[model samples]
Target: MCKAFEEWQEECIQKGEIIGALKTYKKCSFAKEETLKNIITDFSLSEEDAQNCMEKYW
Candidate 1:
């Protein structure tokens, strides 16, 4: 489940809060989708992850 974290990374950079997100991602040991979602949620920000996936893939 080694998906690209580019979108999540961009989001973090845009929010100017990558420190915590990096910490959490590392803490979770980078468990793919769930951890990514956790990172998104941990920031208390909203991103349509599923929609982004669909738009990018489908």
Candidate 2:
């Protein structure tokens, strides 16, 4: 549960980042590898985090 505003903001930001990455992958024709790389690098997320997003959304 998002008990605080800060926690809610963080949750929203994470979801937004994941959705944005997927959108770019679809709309910009970024290769799968490039999208994964960008998600990790551009979003400052870990390899595991990026992979999890791919597993769920890609």
Candidate 3:
């Protein structure tokens, strides 16, 4: 579920695990665009950054 993914991401960050957080984000199957947008906004990342992350992970 989305909530689980969100929690997993948070936990990964709390543990200083960027790779784990990214991997978990890649596993989320619903509303990917919305999620990417949130990531961009939250992290101040560019759309290209989001695309690159997706390409690298997925």
- Prediction RMSDs, each to the true structure: 11.4, 2.7, 10.1
lDDT of 3 by residue, 1-58 (tens): 6999999988667434434455566677536676667666666668997667656654
Clash list (residue pairs), candidate 2: none
Local accuracy by lDDT, each model: 0.54, 0.83, 0.64
Give the candidates in order of lDDT, highest first: 2, 3, 1
Off by over 4 Å in 1: 1-16, 48-58
What is the RMSD, in Å, between candidate 1 and the native fold over all Cα? 11.4
Q: Report the number of clashing residue pairs per model.
A: 0, 0, 0
lDDT of 2 at 28: 81
lDDT of 1 by residue, 6-58 (tens): 87777757555545555555576775566556646665545675335323432
lDDT of 2: 0.83
- Tell me, by TM-score, which candidate is best: 2
Report the candidate with higher TM-score, 1 versus 2. Answer: 2
Q: Tens digit of lDDT per residue, candidate 2, span 1-58?
A: 5469889899898888788778869688888888889889887889998888888887
Determine the backbone clash count of candidate 1: 0
